[model samples]
Target chain A: MVDRIPILKMGKYLLLSIQVDMHDQLALDLQEDLTEQIVRHRAKGVLIDISSLEIVDSFIGRMLSHIANVSRILDAKVIVVGMQPAVAITLVELGLSLEGIATALNIEKGMRWLENSVNEDEIAGEPESDEDTDAPSETGN
Target chain B: MTKTQTLPLKQETDIVIIRQRVRKAAEEARLGLVSQTKIVTAASEIARNALIYGGGGQCLIELANRDGRAAVRLVIADQGPGIADIERALVDGYTSGSGLGLGLSGSRRLVDEFDLKSQPGAGTTVELWKWK
Candidate 1:
């Protein structure tokens, strides 16, 4: 069996810390696994820690973007955190800006961002003032 | 000049090996963190192109000197169907395969020197040099 990266579940979020130097197949497997996990748990957000990766080539870069897009379709947001400075420089020089994927400096900050975004989403989804005014009048009666 | 080591580019794992070897050589040559990362990333890109587009091949890694500066050189060759339009292949985002098409062009940008040689049905060879 091909080795798989473990995904941790934290409340409404899923976390993946890629500690190994992943081969192409391994990366693809992670992509498949993460998406399935998102749907299974109905995760609201995902945090991918890539600080251990020394490099991010085009293939892996595309895989990250693919995961982000796929998770978005599943109603989950994906955030990549802990990218080393050298890897960041190399990735940009390699002509991949990794556009459309959110990034954070560390896992702590990533979780905060995820939590804040989820909260905002909840606030935006709440019933408007018309419903709130009705609730106050009903309580008075 | 150090001895050249050749590794097969037959599978995905081989690409990872190439990256590690290239990074070691780069560090030995005293390349800074970013330069080492660049060469390693470039090596990975070309190596994958060889395995995927070239149907698997071989890579030659060596340490050399250019103008009295130490450098890491890589020659990746494949015997698959060669590219007819080298210029088009070098263009950004022009991949004939399932990739993002940045492997060839982007790798060129990461190294100090880049060379490509290929002919239709004759195979492809890419030489990259990064100086320290």
Candidate 2:
């Protein structure tokens, strides 16, 4: 049996902290399960905390991008948070820019970004702004 | 300079083992945390290639002295079908498999030294070292 990555619901957002190094199958399972969680919860935002993940290979890199894309289609905003400096360097060196994915230095910043975006969606009177934006800022902490 | 540990790369689970071994080797080599992280991440990428693309292989982690500097070296060899074009394979965003095409090139960029050797129907061997 494949171990399921836990998806915790926080208000209108879903939070997932990847503490263990993910196997290929586990990463795939997380992608599928997370999408389902987003749809089920009808969440407005997703915060993925990866501080505990020491390395992110191409597969995991693609999975993160895929999650962001799918969540967008499902009308949920996704914010990736807590990427280690080394992991970020390796990701860029690996050529997986994770372009079109929003990132934050920590969960606190991610929450703030999500809050502002949600407010912007409300203010601009747009459908949550599928504007393909980058991270609000790179604390790189 | 020649102390080394070997791990078989026959399955997916071996990836974690390889990473752990690389981490231990890096620690023994006295690399800084950032250096250790880079090497481990590089090892993870190459080990995955050994299992998925090469159809399983073996990895050797070594503590070596390069130009009188301490370094951790990782050698991954596979017996599967070899890559047809080495240059194209090393280019970023190029993959024959369904992956993101970041395995070879990405691993190369992460380490201080990278070497690749392969021939059709023979096999492939990748050597990487990060000096401390």
Candidate 3:
């Protein structure tokens, strides 16, 4: 059986940290799984941490773009984080600019960006509602 | 021009193996971080093309000297329905398959030397070389 990259649910967001050098099929599987998870959980944001990936070829680059695109259609914002400097240079040299995908330097920054974007969307989506003006409800008991 | 290793490009998982072997060879050649990454990424794109487009093939990793500088060379060959229009195939966003069509043109940009040979009924061979 092929190993799968696990997806964690954090409130209204889904987080996936790819910790392995994923084969092609594995990458496709992650895309399918994440899309399903987003719909099932009604996730508003997604964070894909690729810090462990040493290389990002055209196939993987396309996969990332596909994931971001699909997530956006499902109303979830996607943030890719922790790309190595060398990988960034190589992707550009390889002609894969990875356009349309939002990126951050690290997981912390990615989460913050996702949170802010989702919050901004909520605010923009409900400008006329006074009850939703204060802040998003905290996940507290 | 001593050949270091030869790997089969029959399956998708083999692409990962090819990337690992190429990376090791690049490190052995003492290439810097960015160059190593570039060569490895180039190897990956060409190797996949061999597997997907050229059907199934083999890759030979060779450690060579380019003007006395250490260099790593990868020769990926496949015996499948070969490409007839090499010029059009080299164009960016010109894929016969469902890829983003950056495999050939992008690989050429990443390496110091790129050579492609293909015969319609014979096969396709891509030679990628990067020097330290």
CAPRI class of candidate 1:
medium
What TM-score does chain A of each model score against the native chain A?
A: 0.87, 0.85, 0.87
Per-residue lDDT of candidate 3, residues A1-141 (tens digit): 357999999999999999888889999999999999998998999999999999999999999999999998888899999999999999998899999999999999999999999899888864423354567568677
DockQ, ranked from best to worst: 3, 1, 2
Query: Which candidate, 1 or 2, would have the higher DockQ against the true structure?
Result: 1
Candidate 1 scores an iRMS of 0.6
Runs in model 2 deviating more than 4 A are: A125-141
Which digits, one per residue and each the tens of the lDDT, describe model 1 over residues A88-111? Answer: 998998899999999999999999
Span of ten consecutive residues with least summed lDDT in model 2 chain A: A127-136
TM-score of each: 0.92, 0.90, 0.92
- TM-score of predicted structure 2, chain A: 0.85
The segments of candidate 3 whose C-alpha lies over 4 angstroms from its true place after superposition are A126-141, B1-3
Per-candidate clash tally? 0, 0, 0
lDDT of all predictions, in order shown? 0.92, 0.88, 0.92
**Top lDDT prediction, candidate number:** 3
